[model samples]
Target: MPLHSLNHFKSVFIYDIFIQPADQNYLTARFLRVIGMHQDFFWHAQQTLEKLFKAGLVLNGVSVKSKSHELTKLLPIYEETLGSDAFNSFDKPKKLKAELWSDTSVKDFVTKISALGSADARYGLVGYQSSKDDLFKLDQLVFKLRQRTMGLDWVIGEDFRAEENLQHFNGKTYREFIEQNPTEQIRHLSIPYQELKSIGENTQDLFHAWNFEFQRKSSDIDKIAPGAIAPELAFSLSRIDALLQNIEAFDGFDKEFVPEGFKWLLDNVKVSSHWKKMIETYLSESKK
Candidate 1:
């Protein structure tokens, strides 16, 4: 065979066979000769091949139809050149989409991909011609499953028994269940009960402030003298002004401070009033 064809053969074998258990020096000698390298090139080629394999590719049982008899000798050469860290650098897991609940193939792929060094290998497999949508779906499924698992106990909170029941129905359609048990929908989505409760408490606080301002303003206007402004009315107006100032100081409340404030409130604020009680109840029953 021509030198180029021989080089291609070596590349294929390295990626397809040699890395498994092939003879090293012979393969390196052949590879160096095919590339028109000096006698010293064999060691360099061997080292380079080893590095490539270590960077994460393996070909343990790869098929090579044209060279069945030579496989035994080639396999040892490939194995000697294989690197040790052949499966390290990989991506971490991320959240999944809601649609993968029913995909068995996706679930299987996730299981297999997860067995690989990192969740990131899925990204590489995802737009390839052979596994495109299936791989994507698997990635989505893994993310969703992990999210659900992480949020499980916290989301379910005191309702750990109910959470266990929900897990039993993991393969069931979430939409169908929600439709049948509309009341349960909130709980399913409300995992991390403490977080949900914190959100509810924050909302109540805003509502109470608004109501208090309304009532104070009404009382002030009612008690105002025909020709004189009541002191209570003046005080109420001042309080409203201060509250407005506070609100203004928090321009990006919804996005920035609100989430942190909710966490802080949940952790440090005591549940004392009726409003707090109501918020606690709402969170206790929200989805997980």
Candidate 2:
């Protein structure tokens, strides 16, 4: 490969760095939250979400150059780029969407989290009123948005074209190009393929565990809940519903929701092994 081709090839891995910083910010924010440092926690939480937001933009072929850290600005761009239908992957996604975009909950989250991105929040110059409820909402946002940054890779050879003769990666999907190319001989990239592969795989695993394993979605509270309890008869309704939300509503809520619960549900909730293979076959065929 020519010198320019090598440099272009090396530039392909730059997108991978976004996830690293996002993960670092997330870990630190969780640490701060555990120690009851809400201000510092919000500070790091803003950064973590900002990085992931920008990463999603870049991955989807959007320019984030000179973008503001305020999610108010970035979020509209994100919604336009990815669109509202992006939440279709989540269970009871409309509820989640309303929580993020339409409801007063969104106002509280966006304004407060956006304020935390300011220098005042960083230096402890201002005290924020965000509560643990905000933290749980933050966890949900991260879990939902991080999914956008997870799959696929973005590396365009045309953007770095010195000419037509030098094209090592082109006209192929990311995984296909990486697999077939003789990148081992090229010492130009700081990271080898194995390291890049490991990072991509491990990030998804870590992301799922860190964000959701112990966390419960509010929708989980409605697994057996009625559509509406009668408003006319009320005093005992509040206490009864409170008991369900806090205690016996369903499987994946509060103390019942944990990594062990997650694993056990996965292990036990599936159809029997004999039919699982058949289900997998149907799924594969449906995709085809």
Candidate 3:
């Protein structure tokens, strides 16, 4: 099945774009409010929950209701139908009712958030605009939802079986295939890429580490002489070069912000001791 049509993928994507940013300290509460997209955070979060609940039902072969805004209503029905154990299947939202004024359950906390988006935010109600303090709490809550939703699709045994089959075909999972193939990976990883943009210095290290892991998993490296180019190093260098080339082609990037070292490093790929010394020195300097 195409990834977009999957309910779990849909929910995760919404959470990634809308809720993930809420956790970044760089995005201040005041900035979020003035940015005019605070309401979207709530709206997208609610939609994410709605899709998650529906996916759980559909995967279990239960008929989902046509459309429902009341998450409190949906929760009881889904729990009753699937049994409480299903809640245990994913990373369940942590219990924090004692922290709330009205002694709300974790389930109740989710329902209130759902209401914020489905009714209040959508209609521009007076209380729809969350206060700065409220945004902080909301951000924490959304962060939990985003993390918990990650493992939700694996609740059913069928997804595991299908994944095994997928791995068998190409020795890679659906996600692995997408990661190795960046055009499609961009559709998903863009959110994370944007979030991490604040940390400029480590950008190349992050790419190198991530690409090295992928290459390690899917490619074999043969041992060679000490000064000879190791297959792994050669492959990783090419991957890093490809990434830097793409970054350079990005329109309107300040030339100063683009790592000049990356281009220089790409131009000087070699297996000599001097090349290794250069890399070690460059890495040490990067840390400083």
Number of backbone-clashing residue pairs for each candidate, in the order shown: 21, 0, 0
Off by more than 4 A, model 1: 1-107, 115-130, 150-288
The top-ranked prediction according to lDDT is 2
The local distance difference test score of model 3 is 0.42
TM-score: which candidate is best?
2
**What TM-score should be assigned to candidate 2?**
0.44
Per-residue C-alpha lDDT of model 2 across residues 1-288, encoded as one tens digit per residue: 121332232232223345556767877787788767788888888888888777667555565656777877887787777665233222223434444432335545766788985779889888777653565666667665565552234343542442243355564334334345423212121321222322124433323322334434433332332223224554423321232234444343333222232232223223345544543543454455
Q: Mind giving the per-residue lDDT tens digits that candidate 3 earns over 1-288?
A: 122123333333333333334334224333445455666656665665555554444434444434365667767766665553334222222563333423335575566667776765677873564533344454444333333333232432222323432444342333343334323211122232234332224534333333445444321222222322234454223323343345456354343422343323323222346544654654555456
Model 3, position 87, has a per-residue lDDT of 44
The Cα RMSD in angstroms, rounded to one decimal, for candidate 2 relative to the true structure is 23.6
Global CA lDDT computed for model 2:
0.51
lDDT (Cα, 0-100) at 82 in candidate 3: 53
Error at 207, model 2, angstroms? 28
